[model samples]
Target: MSPGLTADDFDFHLPPELIAQHPPARRSDSRLLDAGSPPALIDRGFRDLPGLLRAGDLVVFNDTRVIPARLWGFKAAGEAGAALGGAVEVLVERVRADNRVWAHVRASKSPKPG
Candidate 1:
């Protein structure tokens, strides 16, 4: 790791409108940002990736299968689960061997620990 490097170095302001809510109609139609060389940013298509590679170049592949792990529920306001505090969205990132999970949660109000 480089000395004095911090997580804040990777933080930036990405406007929410720039975020893609849905995938392209075709998988290969996705946009690719070429930042291999600094000070120059090239916009290319996914199909253009093949010609850019040379022999003996290392390629990393993410083969993790996607699953429907997102859950939608409401925060409980009462013990009997009769009242809804607010809507909650949970994206389960990983399941552990100890029957626990790591997730990204979004809600109007943060849930308190039980």
Candidate 2:
């Protein structure tokens, strides 16, 4: 580990072949590891999820789905060159209370607040 990092900086090594490239045959067939007291071993189906939780337990989920917001276009007659136009990336962080968005974008330069 580097001087600035501790155990938290450690990560496991996984080969590409070890990664799950596709969803399981059935969602319920996915793996789960119980790390709490009396650690139990169980293979459960995704459909069995509701039964595992007690009623009224608050659940938080990331409802944000993917968006194809990438834009690739050249600024005509601009000082910036074609190489700058090739640099394109866009990332939407979150939707704000006022319906505006927080985002991270990349190109040849930064963007001003809207």
What's model 1's overall lDDT? 0.88
lDDT of 2 at 42: 67
* TM-score of each model, in listed order: 0.61, 0.48
- lDDT (tens digit, per residue) of candidate 2 on 17-111: 96778888877787554323345656555576676677887768898777765545433333544443334466667768998877667767654
RMSD of 1: 5.0
Model 1 lDDT tens row, 1-114: 768979998799989998889999999999898888988989899899998899998989999999788999877775666677778899999989998999999988897764
> Positional deviation of 76 in candidate 1, in angstroms?
8.4
Deviation from native of the Cα of residue 106 in model 2, angstroms: 1.7
Q: List the residue pairs that clash in candidate 2.
A: 28-45, 28-46
Each candidate: how many clashes? 0, 2
- Model 1 clash pairs are none
- The parts of candidate 1 lying over 4 Å away from their true place are 1-4, 72-114
Worst 10 residues of 2 by lDDT: 75-84
